[model samples]
Target: MNKEDVSFEIFPPDFVLEPYHVFRKNALANRNRTESQEVDHDMDILYQFWSHFLVRNFNAQMYNEFRSLALDDDFSTRNASTGLHRLIQFYGASLSRNSVMPDQVVRDLVDLIRDEATTRAEHVAFYLLRSAWRSGSLDPRNREKIDSVLDAHMTAELEK
Candidate 1:
């Protein structure tokens, strides 16, 4: 989670005008809204916005922040899972677009999914592994470890 670990220096002068800032603002507003008034429509839009933004921007700090928010137990499970799903999709797209995320960020994401052991987390881990394979960012040994975790998840699901 160190700021220095990720490259935020690639941002151009016009970054302030980017739609991500607008999404961020809306997402924050949604976070503070009362449960009775909150709507999934706004959350869905925010998730979509984040997915598109991350694919283009690929800032580790932003990614970490998004992941932390999504994984926070205080948030509704639906929102958290939706956020994580969008993030996993973003990671795949970003990798295919030739934008490399930091190693630590990837590792952290994988570890989080493994530790959480939810079906949604397993799906996220699968996407992460696919992205890693496509991007060639992970060493074979590490990849095997991730694959093993995914296999275990799948096995557990089948058993249930």
Candidate 2:
């Protein structure tokens, strides 16, 4: 091949190098970069992480964002193109099977039920209950009160 052709040819980096060496270099670079960036941009990085955490912690946000894409809505394809739909589906399935409910997540769920039920809380509660139900941890014997609250909240939402 001509030099230009050779230069333009795409080769998978991992295929050409010892995987460990490539991985070690990448890991070292990533660690150094993150450390330096964290020191210089602490608030910016923290805010970014916190925003991601909130979007994930608030089940209503999670469900609305995902369901909007999973359904045949106008932006479904565009949303799916962002890969969030798959991510949400995987996360939802994992939550359903693992019986893992973080303390913060539960607290947010409760807050939604008590404070935002008529407005934003309603949607969040719906998503939270669905996640809990999927995890098989939302059984009547264990979470009856919360379940009842969610049911009532959902009923209210539907009526609107």
Candidate 3:
């Protein structure tokens, strides 16, 4: 599909982060209390938006901008990190349901898990594995690599 076929326009980072901020605020307010259905609904909308964006831009340059947001240290706070992880998850899940993910995206996610020592890394790794599994895109060798890294991460966490 060409750029013209895409129905949605890519928004600036600030615009993209607006829903995330709203969801984060709701989550923070709901902590230690019963979860609000409204928060869940908001998150669902956010995920849908992200999923659509990923699917439409899977082959476009906008993917690089999205990936940059996911890996950006400026957006690495706890809530932002969680939002990034969910965005990646939605993207991967969409690819799994429709088409194969690009090799570079897989490699970048694996590298993120390998180099980053954060919960976001683990979450991304898990979603990547799920996406690969569902899409039948992961070969045995790549599966082994991801498994090894996840195993090491789990072992470290257990030791701690």
* Deviation of model 1 at 132, angstroms: 6.4
Q: Pick the candidate with the highest TM-score.
A: 1
CA RMSD (A), model 2: 13.6
Worst 10 residues of 1 by lDDT: 71-80
Ranking by TM-score: 1, 3, 2
- Pairs with steric clashes in candidate 2: none
Per-residue lDDT for 1-160 in model 1, tens only? Answer: 7756867778874544336577677767776663532335556566676678766766677776766665562234434466666666665665445444556655665665556565343455554555566657656655554445455654344234
Error of 1 at 104 (Å): 3.0
Clashing pairs in 1: none
Model 3 lDDT tens row, 61-91:
5456455534552144223443455556654
On a 0 to 1 TM-score scale, where does candidate 2 land against the true structure?
0.27
lDDT of each: 0.58, 0.41, 0.51
| Ranking of all candidate structures by their lDDT, best first | 1, 3, 2
Better of 1 and 3 by TM-score: 1
Writing each residue's lDDT as its tens digit, candidate 2 over 1-160 gives 5545565346665544335346434543443344321222332332233335434454555444333432323123322222222333333333443344444444434554454445432244356446565556554442544444455655454334
* Superior by lDDT: candidate 2 or candidate 3: 3
Give the lDDT of residue 77 in candidate 1. Answer: 48
Q: By TM-score, how accurate is candidate 1?
A: 0.53
TM-scores, each model vs. reference: 0.53, 0.27, 0.42
